[model samples]
Every structure is written in structure tokens, then in C-alpha cells.
Target chain A: MIKDITLGQYFPGKSFVHKLDPRMKIILLTFFIVFIFAARNFVSLGIMAAAVFAVICISGVSPKMYFKSIKAIIFIVLFTACLNLFYGTGDPLWQWRFLKITQSGINTAIFIAVRIIALVLISAVLTYTTSPTDLTDGIERLLKPLSVFHIQVHEIAMMMTIALRFIPTLLEETDKIMSAQKARGADFESGNFITRLKALIPILVPLFVSAFRRAFDLAMAMESRCYHGGEGRTRMRVLKYSKKDYLALGASCLIFAGVIICSIYLPATVRTGM
Target chain B: MKFIEVKNVVFAYDAAEEGEEPKTVLKDISFEIEKGSFVALLGHNGSGKSTLAKMFNGILEPESGDIVVNGLNTKEESTILDVRKSVGLVLQNPDNQLVASIVEEDVAFGPENLGIPPEQIRQRVDSALKSVDMYEFRAHAPHKLSGGQKQRVAIAGIIAMEPECIVLDEPTAMLDPQGRKEVMDTVIKLNREKKITIILITHYMDEAVQADRVIVLDDGRIIRDGAPKKVFSEVEFLKCHSLDVPQATELAYRLSSSGMKIEGTPLNETECISAVIKALS
Candidate 1:
């Protein structure tokens, strides 16, 4: 029952978007996010939204899945829109004795909601198309330049890779330990706040113990294979920039430039009293 | 040549709290397993079989003795990696040793750590999966596999490393009957076909009966070391050490005690049945 939570999940596909270099996806996603902030007028925001929807369609991942990702942040989106609606003041459109909704307030709410939606959709597209390992590999390659600052990019990547590798393992362990504890009559579903928390102790204790044990074993196993630290380590699947990736990058750059131009040239709206 | 040589090894686990005396786990254990031999270590709980297995790969340093693996001392830090690589350890719990979410990735983990070339790692992963009949589940999430399948994947991980020897510590302890059969079959096949040395640590007497050699551990010492027939022949001695003889061996022992004429000891069900028929005739 706990497996259906698909936030930040990857959906494997053979679409052109899914086949693009993850490094390019990372760059393009960054470009997309920057353009999202650069969107000042409805025309630019609409263009950006259309581009995201197009990418989503090409990736073959359902819009329903994208909305599922957005659902998690729905509360935050609403809260931000409400805050913007109440705080901004200019040309009151509706007035109650002490409350007022102004023209500027309505504009601000719309802008904030649009920005939130754009941000969520663009980020969701990247995650939906890219696998966790590919994303980590892209990050490692992109951050390889940080080695000049001795940031240990390989170690960070390896850590992320291992963490991603162990998520399912640890989840399975948790499930097993939960069942074991349940068989021992350790109730995790009933009782008050403290009682439930206390029940979790048995599960958590074993899970933590097994996690540490696994870490030690894995470290030993890795060291046994002469993993001295990613120095001069070559990956099995080397990242390569192909023509498709170049096209994707070029298209994203054009959209980003258009957004910047629109943000600079778009006229500011002036509100009159209602 | 002896692939693994342990001489006068002693080991203990230090209590976590300060000012506590270290508890001895293995005491003056001595043995040598030759290359390409399948050996089984059998013992009741707390008999120190696991500690001895750990010493084979230098996971635990002997307190006061020597363990030489493939012409390298296990105590030396420099040779530890070599020892471990030479002798891969598959722990008892199938869940703990698996390092990746996908079966293929888990199989690739060992080769990746060894810094094998990507192409070679891929090939090895494929062949290793095929060796354990898990090739079809290459892309499947390992968490979704049954206990037997997961354990097979774990074996494939070690096999991908291309180790000369594999040590399994109670690989079937948590498995059901079918899972146990699957794992045991894989271990035997790896031993026979790949010529990888197998050191299986198990409590099941039936599992030990198939080994080329069986060594019984009791209170941190080797009580019996011989071929399965020789070891099972001493039924009273095994029972005294808190270990059981194979049921067939027990039945044979019972028949012999009752003054029936059975030619030799039986360590397997088929042999015991034949012995019973002979006695009846």
C-alpha cells in the first residue's frame, strides 16, 4: 500500500525526450527554471507552459502523473496565492468592512499560481524522464569541474548512487522488520500519539541496526573490490552529447532568450479604482 | 596447494561497553582447505562457525594466529583486499548483502567496485545472472523478488566479481523449503561447473551430507573433520556435540544398534533405504 507514492519518481520510456543525454536534460531543466522566473507577462508564461506540456507529451508520461506530482505541493501553491491575494493593495475590486481585494492583488495571485505551476511541471518533467542513476551521473559530470576546488564530486556521486541503490533494500528491510515486530504483537497502528510512537521503537531499532550492519558490510565489500575512491574511475556508461541532446539544448536556449526579451519589453499593468 | 590455511587462530568480540573483558568466539581453530574443494562447516548456534568464516576473508582479524589465503596473510592490511577478492563472502541474510534496486545493477555492483571495464562488467553481469537463472529478472526491482530469487541474485553478485571461492553463511536460514532447494542447487552448480571453491556454513545436517568434507564446530573447536560418511558414522559423538546426524544416518545407527546387519553407514535417504532393505532381506 505504501508503494504508490510516486513523487520524484522515474517512468521508463523509449521516447526521444527519455533518450536525450541526462547531462543535457539537467542543463535544459536549469535553463527552463531560469526562464520560468524571467516570465513577466502572460504571453511568455503561456509559451513556457506550452513548451513544458509539449515536452511532457513527447516523453509519453501521462499528464495525470504530472498533476499527481503537483498535488503534493497543492497546499503550498494555494497558501502562496492566498497570501499574495490578501497583502497586495491597489484599486479595491471587492470590499468588506475590514477586508479588501484589489486589482493588483488579483494579478499577484494569478502570477504566483502560474509561477508555481510552471516550476512544478518543469521539475516533474525532468524527474519523470530521467532515472535516478542517470540524474546522479549527470550531476557528477556537471560538477566534475568542482574538482578544481577539490569538492570530491566522485565521492558525492558515489554516495548518491549508493543511496539510490539502497532505497529499495532498506524499504524491504523495514517491511520485513515491521512484519516481524507485528508478529511479536508490537502494535504500530493503534493507540494515542505517544503509544504509537513507542510501538515504532521496536521497528526503528531493528531497522537502524540492520542499516548500520548493511553499511559496514557494503563498505567492506566495496573496499575488497579495491574502491580506493573514485580517483581515475571510469563509468560503465559514459555520458555522451548526441545531436538530439544538442537540438534539445538549442531549443531550450531559444525559449529562454524569448522569455528574457519578453520580461524586458513587456509593459507594466496600471490598475484604476473599481 | 592449500587455498586457505588457518593455524592456531583465535578471535573474540569486544563488548561495546568499556571495562568489559573480551568474549572469546573462536579458540585455537586450525584447518586447511585445498583448492577446488567444497567444504561445509556445521555447528549449533554460538559455535563460532561465522567468526571462522569471517576470518577466511579477513573481515575479522584473528586475535592470536595466522590465516593465509592464496599465499597472502590475512592480517596484513595490504593483502586484505586481495584476500576478500579471492574469497567472496555471501552472508546468511539474503536481504542485507544485496546493494542495488535492480537485479542487473546488483549483479554489476561487484564488478563495478573492482573497476572492471564497463563492457566487461555488463558481460559478467549477464553471464552471472544466467549462471543463477536470474537473467530474465535483470531489469526487475530486487525487492519484488522472492527470498530464493533474491538470494540467487546475491550469489550472482558475488559470481560477477569472479572470485576463486565463495563462502555462504547459512544462506538458507530464512528461506522456505523450495527456496532452500533453489539456493543449494545453485551453490552446488557453481562449485561443479565454475570450479569456484564453496564454503557453506549451515546448521542443517541434510545440507552438510552433500559436501566433499564436513567440519563440525562445537564450543569454538573443531570436533569432527572428515568425509560425510565418516562424520555421520559417529552418530553418538555428533549428538554429544549438540549436533544431529542426517535422519538416514540416525535410522541406520538405530538399525545397527538393534543388531541388524548393514554394510556401512548411510548419510543420505537413498542409502538408508537400501540399508533397510538389506537388513530386512
Candidate 2:
């Protein structure tokens, strides 16, 4: 059951989106995020939604996965949208003691809900298409400029790689340790809040001890392979942007510009509670 | 010529508590491993075999002796990289040694660290995977692989660096019998075909019997060192040190003690069968 936790879930594919350079994908994702926020009226929001939908279709990941991602944050989305419903001040339709739903309240609630859903779906496109390693590599390259200030960018990237590599291993170990503790009659399920927290100590102690041991062995193994640091080190998988990446970047920028222009020209149908 | 020379190596770990005596792991240990030879180091737990394996790759510096790998003294800070490049050390646990999520990426880790160009690293990674017969699983996640497959990938990671010698410290200790066999076959093939020197530290006498030479350690000191046949022939001495010889040697030793005469010690089953049959005839 614990194995089902899909952190940074990526579906491997030969789709155009998947094949784009990860750095370009990250940049395109940033533009899409800005475009979503820049959207002021229904016209601009609809256009941004259309652009996101097109990219989602191109990503080749099933719509089910995107829905699943949205389902995870459905509570927060609904809660915030509900709070925005009563704050709108235009054309009150229904009145309560301290809460009044206006004509624009419904409009504002729909806008906020749609925006949050669009944000989740669009971000899902980025993660669904890019592998974790590629994403980290892209981030490392993007942050490479920080190294000039003695930021140890390479060290951070290495830590990320190792952490990603060990996630599954540590998860499996946790499962095993939990089972061992259960077999030894350690009750974890029936305890109260504080007792449940205390029950975790037995599992956490062994897990930490094993993690430290694994870390020591890994350091020695890396050293034996002559890993001194990132200095003068070359990467096996080089990130090179292709024509498709440039094309994708151009398209995202154009879409953002269009969204901004539409937001400026269109009459505000929905009150944006900024 | 010797690929690795350990001269009177002495190593000890500082006491964990105050007023406690230091724990000496290895003492006056000396041995020479020839180029392109398969050597097995045999010892029980706490015999310092793993410590000696680390010393080969300059992972742990000797306290009072010298270890020279490929004519580079490991004690020299500047030559440590060169020393490691020549003698790659594979640890006991396969899970801990793999640094990358994917098999091929992990193999490329060594060459990448050495600053090999991307194209060459790719070629090295592919060929190294092929050598270990793990090329088909290049895209497979390491955690998804079996213990034997992971160990082979670990070996490929070392091979990608093109190390002249590899010191494996009980690599199959955590594996099943099948996995142990797989690693042994890989190590033997690498030594015979690739001309890479192999020093395997294992407690399995059967595994040691396959090696060209066997060195037995007892309580931080080398008790015996010679060809496998010669060392296994000294069954009484090995047993006294709490070490085991091959099953065949043990059986022959038992027969000899039971008032039956066995001419030579057999290191494997077939030889033991032949010796027993000859005696019966």
C-alpha cells in the first residue's frame, strides 16, 4: 500500500512534450503559471484554459492522472472558492446575517475554482512529462549561475539526485520495519494521537540508524569511484534544447502575450478579488 | 609484476568510549596481488578483511604501513585519485553502492566523475553493462532489480571507470546462493577475459576454492596464504582459526581422521568423488 505513493509521478512516453528539453519545459511551465495569474476576465481565462488543455492532450498522459492530482487538493480548492463567494460586492442575490451572495459572487467563485483547477492541471503536465532526474538536471542548469557566488550548486544537485535515488529504497525499508514491529506486538493502529506519535519512535529509530549506515557506505562507494565533487565532472546525459523545445517556448510566450492582451481588452465579467 | 603491494599494514579504530583500549583491526598485514590474477581473502567476522579491502582503494589509510596500488602510494594525498582509479572497491551491500536510480546512469557515474566526455561515457556505460550482462536492464530502476542483478550493475559501475583491479568485500554476503554464484561467475569472467585483477573477500570456502590464491585471516593477522589447493590442504589449521575449508576438503579430512588415507586434498566435489572412488577401488 505504501508503494502507491507516487512522488513526482512521470509517465514515460515519446510524445512531443516529453521529448522537450527539461529546461525549456520548466521555462514554459513558468510562463503558463504567469499566464494563469495574469488572466483577469472570463475571455482570458478561457483562452489560457484552452492552451493548457491543448498541452495536456499533447502530453500523452491520461486525463485520469491529471484529475487524480486535482482530486488530492480538491478540499483546498473548494474551501477557498467558497470563501470568495461571499466577498463579492456586486448585485446581491441572496442575503444572510453576515453572508450575502451577490450576482458577481457566483461569477467570482467559478473563476477562483477554475483558476485553481487550471493551475493544478497545467503543473501536472510538467511533472507528468518530465522524469525526476531530468527535472533536477534542468533545475541545476537553471541555478548554475548561482555558483559564481560560491553557492555550491553542484553539491545541491548531487544531494537531490541521491535523495531521489534513495526514496524508494527507504520506503521499502520503512514497510519492512513496520512489519517487523507489528510482528513483535507493537500496536500502532489503536493508539490515541500522542500515543500514535510515540509509537513511531520504534520505527524511526531503526530507520534512522539504517539510513546513516547506508549513507556511510554510499559515501565510501562514491569515493572509490573517484567522485571528488562536481569540479571538472562531465554528465553522461547532457541537456540540449532542440528545435521542438524552441517551438514550445515560443508558443507558450505567444499564448501568455495573447492572454495579457485579451485581459486588457475584454470587459470584466468576473470580479477578481485581489 | 604486482598490481597491489601491502607492506606491513597496520590499522586500528580509536576506542568508542573514554579510557577504553583501541580496537586493532589489522596488524602487520602484508601481501602482493599479481596483475590479472583472482585472489580470495577468507576470514570470519571481525577478521579485518573488509578493512583491508578498503585499504586497497585508499578508502582507509594504513596507520603504520604502506599500500601501493599501480605503483602509487595510497598514503600520498595527490595520488589517491589515481590509486582509486586503478583499484576500484565494491562494498558488501549492493543497495548502498548504486548512486543512481537507473542502471545505466549508475554505471556512467564513475566515468562521469573521472571527467570522461559524454560520448565516451555513453560508450563506456553500454560496454560496461554488456560485460556484466546487464545491458538489457539499462533503463530499469535499480530497486526493481534482484539482488544479483543489482550487484552486477554495481560491478558495471566500477568497470565503467576502467579500473585495473577490483576489490570486492563480501559482495555476495547479503545475497542468496544463486546471487552468490552469479557474482562469482561475473568476477571470474572479468578476471579471465578482461584481464582485470580481482580480490574477493568472502567467508564462503566454495567461493574461495575457485580463486587462484586464498589468503586466510584470523584476528587481524594473516594465518595462511597460498594457492587454494595448498591452503585448503591445511584443513586442521584453518579449523583451529574458526575458518572452514571447502566441503570436499572437510570430507577428505574427516575420512583421513576416520582411519582412511586420502592422498591430496580436493577443493571441489568432482575431485573429492574421484579421490573417494580411487580409495574404494
Q: Considering every candidate listed, which one attains the maximal TM-score?
A: 2
Query: Best-fitting candidate, measured by DockQ?
Result: 2
Task: Provide the overall lDDT of each model, using Cα atoms, as 2-decimal numbers.
Answer: 0.84, 0.91
Error of 2 at B266 (Å): 0.3
Local accuracy of candidate 1 as per-residue lDDT tens digits, A1-274: 4444442489998999999999899888898887777676777877898888888889899889888978989999899888778766767788888678887787877877888888898898889989887898899999999999989998898888778777767776688888888888778888999999888888889889888998887776565444678764545566789999989888887877777787678864323211
> Candidate 2 local accuracy as lDDT?
0.91
What docking tier does model 1 reach?
A: acceptable
**Model 1's DockQ score:** 0.49
The weakest ten consecutive residues by lDDT in model 2 chain B span B233-242
Cα RMSD of all models vs. native, in order, equals 3.2, 1.5
lDDT of 2 by residue, A86-178 (tens): 988866799888899987878888898998899989899989999998888999999999999999999999999999999999999999999
- DockQ (CA atoms), all models: 0.49, 0.90
Residue-level lDDT of model 1, residues B1-281, one tens digit each, is: 68999999988899879999888889899999988999999999999998888788887899999999999999999767677778988877776677656788878877776778899988998999999999999998776789999999998988988999998989999999999999999999999999999999999999998899999999899988999989888889988888998888888888888988887998888888988898888
